[model samples]
Target: MKGGILLLRSIAVISSSVATIISTMLPLFLYVSTPNIELISIFILLIFSAFLIHGVLTHALNDYTDHLSGTDTNSPAILSGGSRVIQTEVFSVESLGRFGKWLSILLVMILLVFLMLGYYRLAVLLFVGLWAAVAYSVPPLRFSYRPFIGEWLCTFPSVLFLGFAGAWLALGSPPEWALQNAVINALICIAWVMVHHIPDLDADKNAVPPKRTSVVWAAEKFGLAWSRLPALTYYFLAFTCTAWLIPERFWAGAGVTIVTAVSALFIFKMNVADPVQVSSYEKIMLMLAILNAVWLGIFI
Candidate 1:
């Protein structure tokens, strides 16, 4: 049971989520954006905790539903599949399901408290987040399995909701610069999901009924190599626009993007035949660079 609980925690991928909220919050922290912004407060920390709880809820529920639907068992990929605890029998699926449900209830209760505090917009966004987190995997609206449509539906919430929730709470109404940055970051977030799906294309296609995710759809329509083109193209557009947004850090950002492109090329060579489980590495590099570049461009 103890081991099971530990494995459950490991799969939350909390650190990545933390990176997201942190980078999103970075814009709010800048002196030029929120002049004389209150540096620290109990409320800010409470909001931060809420974001983490929300992250945990998303991961836990996603794993539970995927396990129940047999998707996790059908065709597992290293980076994108639910944690294998259920498949391995490390924990009963029932127990995992209960864990996710309780987490959901806890998050809803927190949002209600925020509502009572009269942060209407913040609460509403968080509620949308709660819905997206659950519905991403649940039936009647299992967005994750919806192929091309699912990609935007699933990625938009995590980035937009979590990102804006932090920004709105911090700035009340974001200025033009902050708003543009949020939208750009959200686009990058959406593109990042494509990066994730790239490595999972073959695995997802081999599923029981073949889950045709965006990457799978692209691979089917245009071939796997062509599927890679859209994502690479999106990154260039993102970084080019980002360069304009923060010209001082333009080259720094481009440098990171260049390194990621090079890394992608090398990874391509490493697993040319199978497409293996290698695209996940490039995704990680791109994400880290985005997070790091935010700091370099905004804070540094």
Candidate 2:
């Protein structure tokens, strides 16, 4: 049980979120003539902690909701469905419900503190971010199941809000460069998120009433390899944008995106070889993009 709680603590993959925040925020850390190092440091600390807290809350809520729906019972998607802790009986739904609610309250309190600090816009954005996270799996408005809108709801707010938050705190506003990077990164996130759902396509399709992830829906409408076109398109666009915006870092960014593109070409091969191995494919693209961002920051 203790191990399970510990697992839950790390299960939402908070490191990736932190990494994204840092990657997008990297420009602020490096450029900007007269920077507030101390304030930027403080913002990083608070925002980092906020992401951790928010991860816990959202993941717990997701586990509880998925458990109720019996969705995770047979799901094998490592990155999609909720943590299997509840499905494994590691935690009770009641306990998870209590934990999620308490964490939500805690997050709200932190937001209130941010508001009191006069960070009005940041505070409002954080509030909206939290709502989107919770709404991803919560009832009635289960954004996780809402198709493309649901995908946007889950990905953009967290990525953009945090990206903008980091820039806003450091630069007083998200610069055109940061905003461009934010949009590019957001597209990659949504793309990889769709990739993440591919491994679970069969599981989702076989479910009662069927859980239609983007890949599942795509494959239904288009053929298998063809269904992956949109994700591939997003990846290429991100690569082009990175190169166009910062041609100096094209090699660094291109190295990763090219590898990602090659991997995508073979996705059908991998998916067939190991139906559940898509997490590696999804995560690699994300990690490389993150690395590309960091590399871009360093050279600039």
Q: Pick by lDDT: which candidate is best?
A: 2
How high is each candidate's TM-score? 0.76, 0.82
Clash counts per candidate, in order, are 0, 0
lDDT of each: 0.58, 0.63
- Tens digits of per-residue lDDT for model 2, 29-87: 56756456765684666565545545666677767776676566666746666666676
Candidate 2 lands at a TM-score of 0.82
RMSD of each: 4.0, 3.3
lDDT tens digits, residue span 1-300, model 1: 553444444322332344445555665565534543452452365355544544456656766766665566764355556656777776688887888788778879989998999978867766776787777766668777776556467555555555445556666764554444544555555555666666566666776546666667777888767666545554555566655555554544555455446644644554423434454455565555455436533632
For model 2, the superposed segments whose C-alpha errors exceed 4 Å read 1-15, 33-40, 77-80, 112-117, 223-227, 240-263, 266-269
Lowest-sum lDDT 10-residue window in model 1: 10-19
Q: Which residue pairs collide, candidate 2?
A: none
